[model samples]
Target: MNKMAKILLVALLAVVVASCGGRKKLQENPGVSAEIGDTTSGIDPEIQAYMDANGIVDSGRYNLSDPLSNKTIYFEYDSSALDPESDMIVQFHAQHLASTGGSVVLEGHADERGTREYNLALGERRGQTVQAVMSALGASNSDVVSYGEEKPVSAELWQNRRVELLY
Candidate 1:
């Protein structure tokens, strides 16, 4: 064979050998499957503890429309601080993301009382706060976006100030 052909053949052989080793390891670990269908597996202890404490069950999947599943976290007017209930909701989402290796987009919105610029910044802060909590809980793939006063959920001012978790 020519020199180029020989080099290509050697590279292909190496890749095949590496792939076979990975397959062997998966086969040996009967408890671990190739697909991540179990939310309890491969989770950080801290995250698991938080889930247990909050009584948040990981059913291996997330349903946004479920009544128990809280997708929106409302904040107090002009404040980004998360209340106890919001904190719990964030914890649940963080645990799910960490366990499933899924991604989430945190959309922040603010009340229409403030200037557009001010509201946008507040919205961003809210989103970042949620992102920080999720990251601390081992959910690494998260993005934050600020909609500010541009998007309001309801006529009520309280409903406008919120962060929504989108998976």
Candidate 2:
């Protein structure tokens, strides 16, 4: 191969190897339990008892129709502050965690517009923002992971700049 082709090949190989090193860790959800909550909490008492008997706690009154509960909280370009709507959703999630004594994992992501390192830092900041809110609301066991641009909600750049909450 020519010099440029050899260099490109080596760089591609390095990315593949590095990504492989962390693939297993990402795939393993070691402490995540099975689905344990209903989408809403106003079920009949009989059904609620059945659900509780089966270890499912009601996730409480989050407005799924609300933009905030859409599960993808977006950020402005290069900014990590939660918008008012997203902030409400974070508060709801924090309340659930505080009440149930379960854990939440905030998976931070970024659009594919910036350098990988910058995107990674932005993603981490977004996750940390959620983590701070959760802690302040008494969800002490929250965790944060920055996937940066590695995980995209869509091909659209704006859609990718988000944090996904997982429990």
Candidate 3:
């Protein structure tokens, strides 16, 4: 192959390798547990395959209409600092973002142990953190949004600590 072709091939391989499933610990819910809580079931198998091949676990199209609960990227109890576990999730979206040709929203939240302002800033920081990683990975800047703590998945005050990715 020519130099250009070789470069393209290598890049593609990198993406594929980056998609491999990790060796780190993971919780396996044998089959359809709550169905709603079954995050893996929601993602398209093809997408999941691609993600797995690229080292992503929770970053693909989960039929939003199917009642699939959002994949929660947890943080330390009272902080929005992106936990190391969240990197894989962020990476999956970043790669998918390359194919979508559009923007994404990174909605941030806190786990409920902090003051509102701290939570807001924490959320934004979480959002911005995702934004930065996505940008670094492959996504464009215009594709990210940060809705800090304004929207909660549950009415109960305890459900607000989260950072949701809306693509």
Best by lDDT: 1
lDDT of 2 by residue, 92-137 (tens): 5565567567887888999988899999999999999989878866
Per-residue alpha-carbon lDDT of candidate 1 for residues 98-130, written as tens digits (9 for 90 to 100): 756889899999999969999999999999999
Error of 1 at 59 (Å): 25
TM-score of 1: 0.61
- Work out the TM-score per prediction: 0.61, 0.60, 0.54
Stretches of candidate 2 exceeding 4 Å from the true structure: 1-69
lDDT of each: 0.67, 0.63, 0.53
Q: Write the per-residue lDDT of candidate 3 for residues 1-167, one digit (tens) a residue.
A: 35674355346534543443320111123243444333343544444554455454552333322211334555556665654335545555565555445577777777555566777788877777778877865677434344555666776553566667764
Sort the candidates on lDDT, descending order: 1, 2, 3
Best by TM-score: 1
Winner on lDDT (2 vs 3): 2
Model 1 weakest 10-residue run by lDDT: 59-68
Give the winner by lDDT: 1 or 3. 1
